[model samples]
Target: MENTTETTKLLVSDRCDVCGAQAYMRVQLAGGELLFCAHHGNANKAKLEPITLEWHDQSSDLNQA
Candidate 1:
């Protein structure tokens, strides 16, 4: 996958790899990308964070009205 910045955000159509829920976080590894919703993102953060190349998180948007 290409390198992306914080501005390179995910669209609403992006789906989580774990449960097909709307994806709000993208975990980029050397091989590929892994998408996750807020719940799964938080759940797998510990394991994924160490090996992650880039963690594009947008779960903060969930708090907005």
Candidate 2:
């Protein structure tokens, strides 16, 4: 998939599927959507990217300083 950033902000209620931290990335797969915090997202990117239909990433928001 083409590299693109999603504009919509992720809600605070969106928790990481792996660790329950605030999510900054959303991976849409054929099975369903998975919300992930920056750490887990990067950790799983290689495996997930091949199957992800849409990768809505806002991890950069964490560096807005």
lDDT winner among the candidates? 1
TM-score of each: 0.85, 0.83
The Cα error of candidate 2 at residue 26, in Å, is 0.2
Global local distance difference test of model 2: 0.89
1-65 in candidate 1: lDDT tens per residue?
76655456887899999999999999999999999999999999999888999898999888983
lDDT of 2 by residue, 1-65 (tens): 75344344688899999999999999989999999999999999999999999888888889983
User: Over the full model, what C-alpha lDDT does candidate 1 score relative to the true structure?
Assistant: 0.90
TM-score of 1: 0.85
Residue 39 error for model 1, in Å?
A: 0.4
lDDT of 1 at 3: 60
Candidate 2 — worst ten consecutive residues by lDDT sum?
1-10
Steric collisions counted per model = 0, 0
RMSD of each: 3.7, 4.3
Worst ten in a row by lDDT for model 1: 1-10
